[model samples]
Target: MIYLQLFWEFFKTGLFAVGGGMATLPFLQAIGESTGWYTYTDLMNMLAVSESTPGPIGINMATYVGFTAAGIPGAVVATIGEVTPSIIVILIVAAVLHSFRNNPYVDHAFYGLRPASTGLIGAACAAVVLEVLTSIQLVAQEGGILKTAALTLDAAAPLGGVLNLRGVALAAVLLVLTNWVPKVKGLHPIVFIGLSAVVGVVFGFAGV
Candidate 1:
């Protein structure tokens, strides 16, 4: 039953998250809230893990969530669920694409979807920002009233005050190295991802 639920949930996520992997973030966030299998903080960590690992981000996230929910079987079900929608949609579209090839209505519909996809992807990105920044300094499991109040107020603070500077700095450095350095610009994403993982380990050890 749990496996089936995982499949259904991820299937829905993959069905409507049309703009690629990043776009699935919103659906995954909602799933975290709805299922209680994970938390927003878990999603943030999963994003990091997904970005650093092989395969599409959405599939990787789905597998991770599924594993958390129900171990190996959950992972299998979730992965299949994520890909099944795309396969069905593509197969159907391919069968009728020739007919719709010249249809202006179809063209207009796709045009409309472009903006909607962009909006969904943008919202997902914003949600990522909110989760990371809010959790980094704001989350408090236990504390005295003064400490709790301070944490709450800190969480509500806008911008960099609530942001995780270490994570932000790491990202900025990687971006600069990967984009600005000619020798590194051609490096595969996986290479940089591995480097990021090493950096993450170091950060963890250093208590950053």
Candidate 2:
């Protein structure tokens, strides 16, 4: 029953998360909240792991969640569930794409989808940024303009601090190296990833 539920949940995710992998973050968050299979922190870790590893982020996340929830069989089922919708959609699209290639309605539909997907991906990025750079538990507290204004004024306040210093520093260094330093900018992403891993380990050991 649990396996079937997992399959159905991820099938829905794949069916509707029209953009790329990051666009699935919202659905994944909803799934986490609804199922209690994982927490937001777990999702952040999953995102990091998925981004760093091979294959698509969404599929990797589904596999990780499934494995964590059940076992090897769960991983297989979840992964299959995630990809099944894409497979079906692609088959249908391939069959009818030629006919719709010049259809204005289809083109207009895709045009609207572009912005919608962008919005979803942008929201996902914001969520990740908040998770990485701020205290999500504190941020979730009830309040509106006043709370936001207070946080803006007292960024380093005891509750809901402005930034994760370590994460910010790492991000700054990576940005500079990747964008400004000519030599580093030319290197493969894997090189910088390895450096980031080493830095993370050092910081972890230092209790940063």
Compared to the true structure, candidate 2 yields what TM-score?
A: 0.57
TM-score of each: 0.52, 0.57
The lDDT of model 2 is: 0.81
Error of 2 at 53 (Å): 6.8
Q: Could you give candidate 1's per-residue lDDT for residues 46-156 as a string of tens digits?
A: 899998777878889989989988999999999999999999999998979777989999899989999999998897776577555444333434555543423444544
Local error of candidate 2 at residue 180 (angstroms): 2.5
Instruction: Give one digit per residue, the lDDT tens place, for model 2 in 1-208.
Output: 9899989988998899986787788898998899998999998998899887988787898888888777998899888998999999899988797778899998999899999999988977887886666654324345554433223335543334666677778889999999999887999998998898899898782354
lDDT of each: 0.81, 0.81
Worst 10 residues of 2 by lDDT: 144-153
Position 173, candidate 2: lDDT: 92
Among all windows of ten consecutive residues in candidate 1, which has the lowest summed lDDT? Answer: 147-156
